[model samples]
Target: MIRSFAVAAIMAAIMAAIAAPVAAGPIEDAIAGSWRKPADKARDQYRHPAQTLKFLGVKPGQTVVEVSPGGGWYTEILAPAMKGNGKYVAGLANPLASVNAAKSVENFKTKYADKAIYGDIGIGTFGKGVADIVEPGSADVVLTFRNVHNWHMSGWDQEAFNAFFKALKPGGTLGVVEHRLPEGRPDADMKKSGYMKVSYVKMLAEKAGFKLAGSSEVNANPKDTKDYADGVWTLPPTFAKGDVDRAKFAAIGESDRMTLKFVKPK
Candidate 1:
């Protein structure tokens, strides 16, 4: 009877081992998954989605909000990463407010329709002093990518920062990735250049009640002189100059960007 019990225990252990789920691979696997478009995948070398997300402390099962997904560049990766286990809120510009914004919303819906990987994403409208789009104090993480310059230009940076502050839980995080201007560049110069001063961004967030958590150089490109003729748009992707020095800019890759992480103090 003792020998029989030992054999049964061994069998149970083998079955348990077989039933266990496989350990997950690195986050890069999710970014490189088959669901991504080839063009979007190509940009990963510069964007560093895996490293960036890791820095933001994004984990499965957290509630994340992305402000102004704008063609869903990050959405392409975020939607899938959050599928099944987490929540993703997309705070968009009100479509009725702008023809371009209307098109952006339509494109986003069309692209993800019937695609289970996107899961059930929440949609909200933000901008122009309007903050009702996202539920206040409900988000675990709020992220914006290269978008602060637009708000700065529109004279709504403070309002937008305040909205972000309201949207996050007390302990939640705000992650920003924006084109970085050289230190001491005046705010007036930033209006048209699409590059923002790091100090200025931190000031705006601090003014809205957030504390600077940390900053990362993961996305920095020292090759960018921050003095492009057409500003950051002169870099690869946009190449605003249109082949004026395509090879030169392409060699430099994307603009140097600041990756900042801020938190709503608990």
Candidate 2:
């Protein structure tokens, strides 16, 4: 039987649609999964998880260590993405440093105990004077998200970088996402404010013998002028000021960030 010409065309179009493959792969699928907390998913607009990870050369089957996963923001994504294929290790905080640090390590384990969701996430230590977050030269990638400022504040940012370098295999990658302070800002602000200059971050990596491979603006936010009284926390999420110019800060969204990729020398 001969069908109408328009009906044939419509059927052809339907076939084409069914055959076309989805461009987003496992990384994107993991980010969209329902297992992640709603609050964490909402921050994707500012975090740009998939894009940043892609730019950093993350792939399945490679060991990746997430340094000092404060509250596991990236953990939700990294753990699931690496499940069954790669190693996902959390470089835990230094309990010897403070009482809270000890509790943080314990809380992270409990929070991510559901293997059905997080997989087998190994644990290790990362802090001042103690940086072996994994077996030396074991990880293929070492990712630190917005935690550099904390080490800088604690006067051990270099130690953290040295540890990252030690953990990664030769030729491995180190992906860093951090709130950015403008270069014009005084160096002292890096300690007090929750931000670091891109140059300063690069210097730390270089000093640790890692070469800067590339950088991405995937997480950049121009709305952040980087002069908030409460630092990056003045924006949404933290709102450190607590209702002071709340609407204004909300409009600004998250802080501007610099995403960098460095490589440990072979």
Candidate 3:
């Protein structure tokens, strides 16, 4: 009897071990879902969406707010991932305030009009105020990608961080993915260029009452030299030069990016 019990216990342990990865299937399936466009899929190599989301500890059933989900790039992935069990809030710039912002919001609405996939998705306006976009202490995870530089350029970086802090509950996570400048790059340069120094971003977040929880290099591209004619816009996806050495920029792939995670203290 004892021998049989030992064998059964070991078998159960092995099965549980195997089930661990299987249990993570929902997130992986959502990423690979048919709803994604071919172009979006092609960028996965540089974006590292799966690994980045995993690193951010994003899971189903959690309320997630994506700040400035411009063009709904991440929205396409996040909405499906949170489809049945979780909630996704796309906090956009107030469309009423800017023509460009209006276009972005309209595009997002058109993209996710399908109730079967994105009916539960919420819309909020940010960039002007905290409560205007997301409710205070309501989000489990707040994410922003490649947007801090714009905020800094507009002299709203501190306010943006403070808004993020207010939106997240105590112990909530903030995930940031931004084009990275070399360590010694000046703050003034970041205002004009899209790339930002990781240290500066961290300092701003700290000032907004967030603790630097961790950072990941999953999106880093070492080949990028950070001296492009148009800064980060010189890289692929933007190629602001308009076919000027397009192949050269393509070969370099995307800009080196810093993936940072910050947490509001309980």
Candidate 4:
């Protein structure tokens, strides 16, 4: 009995020792400082800047890729955050909406003007008909925000997920943020409303051979009805229908979104 207890104690001590330092890395500090400037206006509807990235487990020196980086909101932050010791790549869709795509590239370029610090990071475009843009097992992290639902609507969700999985190195991370619908909801409702069921996200990740790491509520918005007359976009963020009723839209704010973290198993 004494020998058995001693063996177990030593194993526990080793495990704790191994995990202690990684828990205190500079990644947390970088994430904490992601958005230190103006906090309102166009940036208000975004997911909690620092907290969301931290939950996604972004490290300073890792190769990270953001897909369909529209307008470069997150791209502006990501490039600087991964500067010096890391690589940042934005994989955009080929032939993006003319105005939006051009603006995205321009904004990203302007954000990382100091090449010495940010390294050689540029926007990579993949054609629309192709499924994945990333090289198999090349990146340490693959991220996307509000892009999966559109993939689902376009019947390319499976291909997209597969590409994401292939792009990550073994044990790499995939961070996702999407408008959320409640779990177990019927497909009909999901089809009409842009919000997606969490179960579907989990299932897709699993199908792509990823293990669900965890999830977060950093982006949750309680006022979301998830049943807007014009769908999720009817809420504050997009408010597609302008001049309809500003106050009602203002009250709803942004749609509740599921923030997920998945790991490509080694």
Q: List the global CA lDDT of all models.
A: 0.88, 0.90, 0.89, 0.78
Off by over 4 Å in 2: 1-19, 96-98
Evaluated at residue 143, the lDDT of candidate 2 is: 94
Where model 3 places Cα greater than 4 Å from the true spot, the runs are 1-24, 129-131
**Residue-by-residue lDDT tens digits, candidate 2, 49-135:** 888999999988989998878888888888988888898999987778899999998899999999987889989888778958889
The pairs that clash in candidate 1 are: none
Tens digits of per-residue lDDT for model 4, 1-266: 99999999999999999888765444434334434345432554556767788899887889899988776667656776677778788887664657766776676677666665445775665434655566667899999998878878877787788888888999999999999987766876666678888899888899999999999999998887786678888876678788788788877777788999999999
> How do all the candidates rank in terms of lDDT, highest first?
2, 3, 1, 4
Candidate 1 lDDT tens digits, 1-266: 99999999999999999999887643555687787889889999899998899999987788889998887888877877787878878998788888988988887788876457787887888878687658899889999999999999989998998999999999999999999998878667889899999999999999999999999999999999988768899998999989788999999999899999999999
Candidate 1 wrongly placed segments (more than 4 Å): 1-27
TM-score of each: 0.88, 0.91, 0.90, 0.77
- Give candidate 4's whole-model lDDT: 0.78
For model 1, where is the 10-residue window of minimal lDDT?
23-32
> Going through the candidates in order, what is the number of backbone clashes in each?
0, 0, 0, 0
